[model samples]
Each structure stands twice: as C-alpha cells, then as structure tokens.
Target chain A: PQNNKSVHCHHPCKNIHVFQKVAGIVIGKSDVKSFPDRKNIGVDRFTFSFTVKDSPDFFINVTAWGNDGYINLLSGSFSVGDCVVIENPLVATKDPEKGERFCPTTPSHYRLLVTEAHSQVYLCADIDTMDRLLPLIHLPVKDSRDFYSLGDIVANGQKLDGTVINVLAAVKSIGEPKQFTTSDRRKGQRLEVKLFDDSVSSLPLVCWDREAIQLVQTLIPKETVLFIADVKISFDSFRNSMAATVNSKTIITVNPDTREASLLFSYAKEASESGALDQDEKPEDAKTIINIVMFLDSITDVYTVTQLKEKAQENPEAFFGITYSFISKLDLDSSVSKVIRTRCTRCKLQVMEETQSCPNQLCPGRDQAFSASTGFDLLVDFTDHTGTVHGCALRSPMAEQALGCTTNEFTMLTDDQRTAMKWKFLLERCKIYVKILPSTKMRTGIRGVILACTRADPGEVKQHMSALLQRL
Target chain B: RQTQETLTKKPAVENSLRILTAVIDGMRHWSQFKDKVPYLFEIFATLDSAVTVGRHGAKNFLMRDGKEVVQCVFYENEQELPRLIRGQVHRCVGNYDRSTDVLVCVSVRPGLPSELRNAQEAVKACDAEMRVLVKSISEV
Candidate 1:
C-alpha cells in the first residue's frame, strides 16, 4: 500500500523534475496540425501525435509541439512501424472532455507531452531491443477472436451503436480514396471498403486516417481477411443502418494465425471463386428502386418459397423477388423487447442513457438534454406450408406505415389492443417485395429486407398462386 | 400442453393422430373419428365476440361463419393464451371430444383472414388436403 502512491500518477505525472525513459515501436503516427496562436499576433504552433507500444499489452500516445522547423524535423525523422525511445517526456492527465475522442485510447490515464529542448525521441539503436519491440506490431490491442461478425452487429442494432468493438470479416470491395477539405479548411481523405462474412452480405468500413487508408490500398479484396480490433461501430443515421469506422485506437491485423481468420479466409476464397463477390458493386438502375413501389403492376418476377431458398444458395450480392406470403402471426408472443426497438434520439449516432451523459462519443446530442425515439423494429419471418425465411428487417417508417399507427400512437395501446392491432395485418394474406442476401451456412438462414408489404386481396393471392403453380 | 409433448418426439405416437385440415363446411364429419382415435385436427375459423368463462379455468368459444359453426372450449387451467381478435381467421389445433362434439383446444395460431364468401374456396382446398392426410394415417 505504501508503494501505491505512484499507481495513479505513474512515474510521469507525479513530478516533472524526475528523469524517465520510455521505449517502444512507433505503431501509429499522424500528420501535423499547424495553427496561429489565438492571442499572439503572428506566431504559429504546430502539433502531432505518434503512438508507441512498448509491451504487448501497453501503449501510449506521445504528443509533440514546437515551431514549424522542430515539428517537421521530429516527425520526418522517423516513420510508422519504427522503433523509438523517449527520455524525460512530461506526463500529464488527459483532457477529460476531448481526450477520449482526440487521442487513441490507452490503458494508462495519462499521456506524455514532448516539450522542446527538454525531451528527446530517437530510433532505438539496440538490435536486441528493436527485435523484441517490432514483433508486437503483429499483435492486436484486443483478442483476435473477440470480434463481432457482421450479422451480429446488425442484429444488436443500436444497442451496439456508437460502441467500440472488434470485427472479423473479409474485404468485399475497396472504394477509391477521395480527398476533401474539412469545414475548418484542413485537408482530409476517406476510403470506404465493404466487408462481408457468412452471416451478413455487405457492410461498410470507413477509414479516415492516412496511415490506415494507405494500408488498405495495397490489399487485394476477397483474398484478404482482416481481424480489426477496437473499431468503432456506429448507427449511420444517414444510411439508416449500421457502419464501422477505423479510429486511432483501432489496430487491424491482416490474416493473422487464428482459426476464425483462416475459416473466413476460406470463405473469402470460395466466394471469390464463384465470382459472387462483385455482384453488389454495381447499383441496379433507378428503375429497379422504383419497382419496389410499383411492384404490383410493374414487376412480374415472382418466386415461391422453395425458389427463394435456392436463389440464396447461389450467393448473389442481393436479389430482388416478389413472393406471396401468409406474413401471418409473425410468431407473435415475441417478447416486448424484440417487438419494440427504442433508440436514443441522442445516440444511433439516437438517444442517451438514464444518466444525463450520452455514452456515445460520436453522438451530436451527447451534451444536450436526453431524448429518444421508439418504434417497431421487427424481424418478421415469412413462411408458407413449404419453408420459412427468418428475420426480414421491418423497421420504421415502413413499419409505422404497414402497422397503420404512428410510433407515438402505438405507445398508447393496451396489451390486448396491441395484440389486436398487430393481428390486423399479421393475419392477412400479403404481397411482399423483398431483397434477399445469403447468410452464413452456420445457420441455414437468409436475410431479407422487406421493401414493401401489402395486405393482398385474397383473390389476388389466388390469382398469383395459380400463375406460379402453372410455371412450376 | 406439457403432457402432450410426446406427440412431437415419438414416431408411433404421431402416426395415430392425423393433423387433418378443416373448414367450417363439413368439419362436423371429423367428429366420427373422435370415438376411434385421439387424433389431432387443424381448423381455420374465426371466433364470435361472446365468450363465456367457466369455473375450473374453462373458457367457451364459438368458431362460426353465419350458419357454419363449431364449439371450442379451452381448459388450460393456469396459463392465459394470447387473446385473438374477433373476425380474424386463426388455425386452432386440438382434439374433438366424442361425447360433446366440442374442440378441446391445445394451441391457436392467427391465420390469414378472408371473406365469408371465400369460406367455400377454403373448404375446397381443405377437403383435398384432408383426404391425403387421412389416407396417410389409415395406411400407417
């Protein structure tokens, strides 16, 4: 207990007068941010960060600042993946409000500030030390197996929204890097890559870091399996879905020696061999989207339940087909939690928690008054006498329109009224337009996104069935 | 309901009960088999609003479309079932008591609702399915 005094401060934060040395490999380095002094008339201050990992479990961010000459010389002297040693760096508590978002997350509560004329950073000259440090680069910050599959992320919905998580998937496609200027006039670039596994068909992973984007550019899609650790998963309100982002804390391990990665590697190899990888790359022409609305009259390609099952096995990027379904009962008696999905208006990227503070670091309303949006986000399985298709994402505003009640209005119904209200449509012969994607064979299931669900006139169902039966 | 789970696993126990599809038109014909075997049946019908709750946890129900009607009684002592709304079609699976001609219920699943005029159309399909299912049970 007597030696525990420096536990909170470590060696760095307790006293600035003491001399200390830290050695590690430079795992990540950032570009410089040069800005004029707000109070001073002419002088400019330059700053940047380079993260160094000394041990397999420990890493710290070293933020440096000086005039343009000192900053450039220091940043240009070494590159990412280089081994470095710092002597007499000042350790201080991280800025509580901005630190978590601004810098990479570290186990320690403090970060080292490299000041001019006092601290020094030089490449580690010892071969023995460098040998031990460089191999740590292959290690992930989190366990490789501790990752969420693409389907698991979507299934969790907004509960996992704005939370950091590890992911295991193969790269489906990588988009060309696009350059832009931030509103603050700083230059920025983003490269988006689509990832997929057996469970989910497609998901987007966005990289804003120059280092990360560069590493991604060299990779071949479908041939590569990535075990991305500490990646931030967020609800993209823009797309009304979930997406992953590579951040400072994220460390991507490319095709590591792990059972999960090798299995995914094999899946990537098989999916590519069939040439099913690029099926989703080209967006179907505008006419296809419009057909979702004009489905009844315009679209004529109808599939039976068995036909839908066979098409999923073909592994298309996504296939659109019309099916006449009982869409009935929805196996109601589904627990209330699955029946109604509540999202924080402040978190999704939606609402906050019981406390005043929103847990989502990326939330726009993080510091504001808490508010929420609750709606029917159901996974209505479509079934007939033949087979069943599970978990078609039926979310609002489509859910509200199909249920014929506003989310707010639905909140007022009693348990009996809710059951009766739901029974109104669940017990109806329906015309359903769905977009299907193949799922992991682990669960012999397919994921369907219902584009439109309409209570079909029973006569229309009979007519369609008769037509389908004739073709069969 | 827990006591009847044997029907799900035992193949011989399953062979004796045919899940005959029924419509209101001629489901009365199924009563004749009630004295022969404790067979299962699935009937597509709608409930009348007038429900009578009896002592000993018994509840009485009517499944009818105008003149076509059948009586159903649910006797799950403690468990309360999901209340199905009136005029909505449901598939009720149960056994018929030979003495009373009452459908003693096990489970009810909400089904696709159609007009009473469509009831004849439903009967035509069910009659064909019933023949095939009944033939399978008799052969076994």
Candidate 2:
C-alpha cells in the first residue's frame, strides 16, 4: 500500500527524493574547517573531490556543510580511491570569485552539497571498478613539486618562506591525547605522534583540537600510513628537532590511495618483517596467527585445495582447513632419517648433544637442568581430486599423530623400523583434515605449510564419500 | 494326494504373483534407470586402439562421444574388453575420473540397441564426438 504513492518534486527547491545520485571514486580531500552559523555557533565543513566513473576527466567537488555531526561522519567514512554513491544530492554552480581558491582542486564548474537530513553517501564495494581507477587517481600537486623529508627539515633548522610542502610518512607512534585550555578559555585536545618515512630520520607531528583526539582513538601506529598535506614546518628548540604543526587548513589522510602511501606501507611491512623494529612495533599481520587460531577454535569450515589456495592468496594471514585424501609419502627415506632432533623445550632451539644446554641465554633451560625435547619434520603429498599439494607437518604432536607412536618411543626405534612405520601408517586411503599456515616469504601467495594433520572421523568420511558417490 | 493338494493352492499363489508383476512393471516405467544405478552409455564414431599394459594388466582406450573425447581404462578384474574398432558404436558404464579427465569403465559392451540407433547416427554426423554423460569417479 505504501509503494502505490506517486512521487512529485517541487519546483524551487531540489526535491530530496527525485535528485539524481552521483557515482565516482574519491580522489582528494580538504582539511576540516569551522565557520559561524546564523546564531554565531561554529559548524564544521568537510569537502572532498572525486572523478566521474564514466568520464574520468570530469571531477565533482562535494561539500558537507553546517553540521559537525554530519561532517564527522563523512570524515570517518570516506577515503580516496573509494567508489561511492551520494543519493538525493543538491547540485550547485561554483561561484566565479571562489574559483581556484578552494583547497581540493576540482575541474568541474558544478559542486554537490550533502547534509545529514537530505542526503545519503554510500561507499561502493565494486572491487573491479576500484582496481581499474586505482592507478589513475593522481594527487593534485604540481608536477615540479618539491616535497621536503623529515631529515631535510631537521638539518635545515629554518622554515622556507611562502612554500607549502607535503610529507608522506607512516605513523610510527602516538602519544596520549591530553586536554588543554586555550588562551580564550576554550578547552582543546592535543596529541603528538611520531612519523617516519623511507628516510633515516623521523619527525614529531603535533595535532590539535578534534583531529588529535581522533588520531589517538583510531590510529594504530606503525600500521597506519599517513599523508600530511599543507602543514607548517618548525624547529622544536627544546628537543632540537624539526616538527610539523597541524592547523585548521592542514589535511591529514590516513592510508590514502596513492603511490606514495603504498610505498610507505611496503616500507613499514619490510621493517616489521626484518626485525629492525621492536616486537611491539610489528605490523598488524604479525598478530594474524593468534587471530586465526582463535577463529579456527570456534568454527569448522573445510576448504578444498583450490579454495584454500584462492583464499590464501586473498588473505594469507588467516588459517584454513583442507580435506585431502592421502596420496603418498614424498621423500619418505630422507624425511624419516632427520625426523628426530634434540631441541630446548623452552626456546625450541636445536641444542647440540655436546653442549648439553640451551644456547639461548634468555631461555629458562639455560640456567636450569637440561630439558630436551624431540621434534620432527614430516613432509607428505596429498590430493583432493582437484589438485595436489605438499603438506609439511612439523614438531612432536603432529609426528606422533602421523606415526602412531610417542616421540620417545619413536626416537628409540631403529632407522629401518621408523621407515617401516611411516610406510604402514601414512598410506591409508582415508580423508584427513590439515591446518595450513601460510608462508611468510610470499605475502598474499597461495603456498602454505601444513601446521597440523589428523584423520577425519570414519563416520563423517563415510557420509562424505556417499554424497560424492551420488554426485558421480 | 500331495499333487492334488498343490493344485488346490496354485490359484491363490498365482493371484499374488500377478499383483507383484504389476508393481514391478509400474516401478520400471516410472523410475529412471540412470538415477537408480550410476551408469552411462555413449556411442563412439571412432575409438583409439586399445593398449594393454603388463604392469597392471590394464587396457586403456580413447573414444569420442557427442560432446567431448573421453579416455576409458579397464582393469583385469573387470571383464576383458574387445578390441576397439573404428566406426563401431559401443555402450559403456563406469565412474568418472576427475584427475586425468577420463572415464574408468567397469563394463564395456559393444553395439547399441535398436532404440539407440538414432544416437549412433548423431555420433556419425559429428566426427569424434562425445555422447556420454558420466560424472568423474575421482569426484567420489
């Protein structure tokens, strides 16, 4: 009954329900600005620019004005390179006097305005369109742009006059957000964050007002790449280093879609991987194993070899399960020969038989009595009709399960006996569940190492086999 | 006296047998044969020469049905397969092989019935065509 109503648009004002929606990818953003309203109360303005999807040459500028709540929502939701749709928008012509003076440069004459009550902005999830426009969205800086590094600013110790410079860096650390009273008795928040680039030196970036509080609450240092635009450079005499002061017109982008941001991300990833940074300074992916372990504990979603490969390529940090039929033991003789090795229980480092102690000084076994444990490295080939993969199951628990014997008993067996046992237990024609841990060497690559292996329940396998047989 | 007793009971047994025969006829007509048993039949316009391997006592053959070319493997445990002659239609039943894209035939019988003669003609029209719809055995 509600759908039967006829929609009508009024003549003078742009009707809220009849306006055409604009679809494009965000390419640039301006800094947040506050202006006085009719009652002299301050309101925030958030503006961004985007290129039309069908016509990339045409750029549209969007201004969300007069409401701090709507401005904050837009600021938190929209980012560059995100394809978005703004519905029921109010299109207005740009004033000639304000031409070229706007912060985010746009090519089109028309501008769009959206408010919380009259408009809606939806971030598009079209991955293909985003991929196509990814490399095309260039920053609006000049071709001969001379950006200064943190090292250059610190060495110069003096500000360059009438020059606006940009710095592309990753957030290295963040200080606690503190509230401070301004000269006019207005309460404001301040936060100091450390930023690093490909250079050897780093800069201390000070943010004030709402931005400081937002950074302290949302940003994860060393993981978030930041592009600081139009910030005034100054020398901190007390620390004797260069610092950048964030102001009302300074635009700060977190993980923006730009070549420089990607480069900084790769640098941060490399630093985290090479152990050049501290343990606590590692990137978010370093904690993926713990997240995956927690995720796998609650759910059981078995993936095929092909599905596992595709999923691993998408997100290599997540653990996946593969149901595979046992093929054959690959390099059985070589694997069994080096199966048993003495390792420190605490450090898991291979301890030499002569030392009779753990080599790692930090390990508890170094000071205590020698606590040795046996470990195994078993590699086998498995297949699931669709594809074949080499599964490497390491350590004692997996070895005990695969060999059907305890590690102590296995160590006491002769080499020939171990080989025989491997042949006997590994060749069964049954379905098995294998947990795959992605290799760190190839990020977003398909190859994974088998972390654990266990035979599936016979009853469940029978049901699966019957279902498969019916399909066949 | 025993013959006389059997004769007296024969009519009742015959009546029950007639009802059983009617039920079997209804089931045969209503139920699809392919759905009951996993079987496939294909007419081949041409078949490759069968090669017998001594190691596994297996014979491998390649044939083209209407849709695609399929490889057929028969083991010693199954009945021996006659030599594949070109331009002759044969019926095959087996599980599908996903790995090698082959049909592992358990039973290969030569010649199509009169009802399937049109299928044989269709195969002849399209040279080296696949006529079978067997699912892959490795899928199981």
Candidate 3:
C-alpha cells in the first residue's frame, strides 16, 4: 500500500504538483471533440468523468489531448465500469472566459488536465473495493432523450421525411453478409438485421460498411441485444414500412451493460426456444404448422425421463417425443372404468352402447354404427429404468395395432375373451413411442400421449437379457 | 420388375433385423431397456441418507458411490417400508424411474445378495439392515 497515502485536494484548492496520483471509477465519457488551437492546428480532446475515491459523490472531469494512437488507447482500453489511477495529473481550474468550465458538464468545480509531460495512466486492478463505491457515481438518465421503442417511433410518424432515432433492441434475425456496390461506385459490405423490442413489433435495420462487418463478427441472433444510437430512419416506399440505416456516427454496443438489454435477451431466447413467437397471437397458418412439423421431424434422439424433465424446465411449452418400454399398469382407481365404447370416426364422439349409434348429430349415419368407430382409452404406466410416468394411449391406428385387433372386432368378443386379450397384449412388455407435452399450468408436471406401440420380440428380448447380465 | 423389387425388399428386411439384433446386444442397464423387456437385477448400496416428507408424500433416500448418488423414492402402498437406518449397506431391486432427474427406486426388496455371498457377509458385518418394501417383493 505504498501508494495508499491520502492526499487532500478539495474545491478552492491550488493546482497540484506533478507526480500526484488520484484514483476513481470512470463513470462517463464524451465523444472525441476537435478544436483549432492558437496555431490553427487541429487538436483532439478526450474527456472522462470520474467519481474520486476520497470523495465518492464529487465528480472530477479528466481531459486528455493526444494523437490518434493515444486517444484510441484511452477510449478502447477503458470503459464506463473501469477503475483507474491517473499518475502525474495536473489539477487545474477551468477558464471562465472560454467557457471551459462547462466543457464536460460535470458538477465538480475543478478538473484534471493530462498532457505529454504528465500522462502516466494506471488502470486499477482492485475492482471488489471499487464496486462498493459505484453507488456514489451517478450517471444522468438518458432513456427519455435517446431511447425510443419501435412502437413509439412508428406511432409518432416522425419518419415521414426521414428522422434519425436511437433504440435499444435485440436482433431477432439477420441475413447473410454480402458485398454490394454503393451509390458512389465503391464496393462495400451490407447486411439486413431485424430488431424487436418489448412491444413485440419489429423493424428492419440495415448495417452498411464497417458496422455491417462488425455486426457479422459479433452478432448472434436471438442472443445478442444491441444498443444502437443515432440510426437514420427511412420509410421504404415499396414495403410501406419504416427502417433504420446505420451511418458512421451510429454507436453500436453488443450486449451492453443495461437492464433492458438483459431482459430483451432473455425474452428473445425463451420465445425462440419454445416456438411461442410463432404459435401465440397468430392465425393457424400453413407456415406455422409446417414449423411445428419440422421441429417434430428433427427429433431423433431417445431421451430418458430425467433428460425430458430437464428439457421441460428449459422450454416448458415444447413437446418432446420419448420412447419407453411398458413396465406395468398402475392400479386403476374408481374413476377408471373398464367399459368398451363406440365413437364417431370423424369427430371422435361416443355412441350409445345399446343402439350402437353415433351420439353426434352431425354424423352421416344419424343413429347407426356405420358412421361410428370403436376404440378404448387406456392409461398405462411405463418405465425405462430412470423413472415411472403414466401415458394415455388414445384410440388411434397405433392403439389398434397394440391391441392386435381392430376395435370393432374387440367389441364383438365376449367379456371373458376380452379379459384374456388384455392380459396377452396390453400387459405384455413392449416398446411405446409417446409425445410428452409439458403442463402449461405451473407445477402440474408433464403429460404423455402414446403415438405408437409394438410388442417386444422374444428372441431379441432373450439376447438383450444375456448381454445385460454380462454387463452386470 | 416385380422380382427385382422383391429381391431389394428381402435384403432390406434382413438388414433391419441385423441392426435390431445389434441394438439389443448393446443393452446393459435398466435405463437401456427402451422397447425391450426389463431384466431384474439387484443393487448393493449404502443407504447414506434419507429425507421423508409428509405422510402422503414419498420418502426420498440416497445411496452414494463417491461420484454418483442414486436417489430412491419410497412410496407407502399396501405394505409399510421398514425403517432405513443411515450409513448401512443394503441389497435391493425394483423398477427404475428414468424420468426423474435422480436415480429413483419405484420399488425395492431388502435382502442378502444370492450371487455375492461373501460381499453380503461383509455388508452384514457393517451392520446393514434388511428394509425391503413387502409389496415390491410380492409383485415381483
């Protein structure tokens, strides 16, 4: 702690000598400002606001002037959260005549000037202690001035004659980067990115030149939330929609340190994973159904119950297809009835037992078995060694195959024969494919629907048992 | 054309059967018994810990092997569960609950391993108790 010695520097104080050090967290930074000196040469000034360790509430503005390399290093290496100790800094009063006191717009009466003679800047490594003082460093809220939601910007109709606005949004989708010729005949790269806000409305953002290249390098759709500032808005006549164009001054921050950015990223991730964005608040279009079919077709791995439970936690609304062998049926309660029934083929409405007529009035045969189908609802408990879960095998083509005979044939059999059939077929060890749908209601667990079932071959089961014994 | 189709179909069917046989041959644990009949096997484990909830809720017990912990959920059915004293070795078997995040015992029988008599003697020397659920044994 050699440099831990405290020095007293306060308001109405004299300028400090060279080699004096001060430590603080960099709270704010201004864009590079250029000015012409007395020699008529262009000079670049970089200003940063910091809350000193000695007086946490008092901000001290630090201004540095240098060449491109020095300015770039100061801005690039240090960000808003960094704690730095500037060595050999000159504490100076602002010039009232030139209005330099208001140059950085900080509340402090005095400022620090860093020049070539005293430009030793040390970035501090002790962040844990500095984090405690972060509450003292106050940054003015700029959301009202700079930030605009897509819904608000659209409703305002400010882009009628092309207005530039700042927005904080998450990139929902991005097109492949492509090289294109600019209107000036120069070759440049451009890409189209779709940005969405909490309003659920989306707007197209076009990134050109260097920004497009940077976006291609760092942007991950549905994961990266960006803070895009000062983007030019233009109405596309052909599409009859508003779009944002990236220009040189547009400041693009990927995954910025902001609460809104984190919230937007999580929302985008959940919507994308659960397919909620497509299914919710939209008509049942062919495209939406096709997306679900594609997702179902893409599933190839057979997951155990433990894996399925974890998947349910990650995306609660998504359905997972699982294959398991039948272990046994749980003991039936009073609610479960061992009754055979007939149902309408089209609507699946049950028919009267005595008349064998469809109960549904819309059936083609008003009151006859000709328009109805026969099948039974079964709830069987299954296990794959990991856990036990109950699944409903609805009366479908797969259920009929599992039962070994058509529902109509089973309905015609005597009660004694039906009981024997249940023992021979339903109670036997077999493979069943089921689609497990997670319960939408909180804490209700998962529900499974059997899609297909097949009996286990005797020879294969024998071979499997032998191999399993060897492993044990 | 019909003969050529039948020749192609015959080889495809034979190839499928060969693949099915290979898949069956790879079966080891109860977790691998998807679409296949389950084989009864016993697990010799130390009952390291136990957690019991309300009267209606199932009791969760743990058996550990330093690296992995197999959780057993014991439900009170027609038969009552024998008191499980901790840190004692026991041999048990029942249906495996694969859907659970942890390894669970759908049912279990407490007994000495018929195959590993010497190991059972060692476990008995360590003061292991027989705490089988009677219903699980009866069902098997």
Question: Could you report the DockQ of all the candidates, in the order they appear?
Answer: 0.06, 0.01, 0.02
Provide the lDDT at A412 for model 2: 77
Q: List the residue pairs that clash in candidate 1.
A: A198-A440, A344-A350, A344-A351, A345-A350, A345-A351, A346-A350, A346-A351, A347-A350, A347-A351
* Model 3 CAPRI quality: incorrect
CA error at residue A400 for candidate 1, angstroms? 18
Stretches of candidate 3 exceeding 4 Å from the true structure: A1-63, A72-76, A79-82, A87-113, A129-147, A159-166, A173-193, A204-220, A226-263, A275-472, B1-140
| Global lDDT of each candidate | 0.67, 0.51, 0.51
- The candidate maximizing DockQ is 1
Query: What tens digits encode model 3's per-residue C-alpha lDDT throughout A167-233?
Result: 7787777876655444465555667887776664356788764523554456787777777666777
Range of the 10 consecutive residues with the lowest summed lDDT in candidate 2 chain A: A1-10
Task: Write model 1 residue lDDT over A1-472, tens digit each, in one string.
Answer: 0111222335542222243777787877677778897767699998889777877777777888788999888987887678988887776666657545666666656677786767899889999988888887766667666889987887765456668999999998899876655546566787899898987667789999887897788778988888887889875533444689998777676766578889999998998888776674565322223222333233356775556877887765556677866563453344656667667653452332234555666555444455566666778866543345767877665565567776667767676677666555553456787767777752644778776687767676556545544443
- Poorest stretch of ten by lDDT in candidate 1 chain A: A1-10
- Please identify which of the two predictions, 2 or 3, would achieve the higher DockQ against the true structure: 3
Best model per lDDT: 1
What's model 1's lDDT at B96?
69
Docking class of 2: incorrect
DockQ score, prediction 2: 0.01
